[model samples]
Target: MNTGEKDWDKKGWKDVPIAGLITEPGTARRYKTGEWRTHRPVWDPEKCINCLLCWIYCPDSAIQVKDGKVVGIDLEHCKGCGICAHECPSKVRAINMVLESEAEAEDGEKVKEETMREGEEGEKERKEERKGEGGNEK
Candidate 1:
């Protein structure tokens, strides 16, 4: 008898099925060290079926459910892999992945540009006031 045969004593499956996919025999796959997250998951409660697959499949524990609604990522702990987006099985797809690049952040380059513009406007106004005062003194 083959030792690999399934034992009936084990619960559930009688035997493990063979996998169809196989890695290259002598190739080493390299992975990125740091957490990878280009996008975050956004949920729409109206469309959510509350199946909880997103919460269960998340390796990072990023998905949360509160008050019967689904929420994604703590940000402090979430490393977005789009796993939640992929796992969500609703026909309408309630969850969406949003990019979190520097351009998307609150204090990003666009905000800096707006602040600089405001500062320049203020400086111009101050210069005009000074010119008007000098003319009054003349």
Candidate 2:
């Protein structure tokens, strides 16, 4: 097939690298844009109906999925565009767009709660071990 060739450099344009240009496939993954987000989407696992609309509509592909269900939101690449929350069904209301600071506070609370629960469990286990040791000795 004879194809007409046009001059790509007719305007003296050089093939120089530019920021945010997709010169190579899958290059966008290297650049994390999550820092640019002002708000973050918080997913409520109990309220989610596995609609997958958020996964489909998310521009950042941050919705994590497993076994045909949404597992969580990947904050590493999530741009906090709120598209996932917006795409979520109104009745489900599983995804909520919260301020970054508020989300941080919520996350910190969760971590604290988890630590407390672990401490309690550890204490209970130690008490049980002590009782077993003391009963056998006596």
The residue pairs in collision within model 2 are: none
Error of 2 at 44 (Å): 0.6
Q: What's model 1's overall lDDT? A: 0.54
For candidate 2, the TM-score is 0.58
The sequence of per-residue lDDT tens digits that candidate 2 reaches over residues 1-138 is: 112253343333255455424454433343445557679898899999998999999986678776789877766568899999898999999999999877778688785465456444544544554453321110
lDDT of 2 at 32: 41
As a whole number from 0 to 100, the lDDT of residue 2 in candidate 1 is: 24
lDDT of all the models against the reference? Answer: 0.54, 0.68
The TM-scores, one per candidate, come to 0.44, 0.58
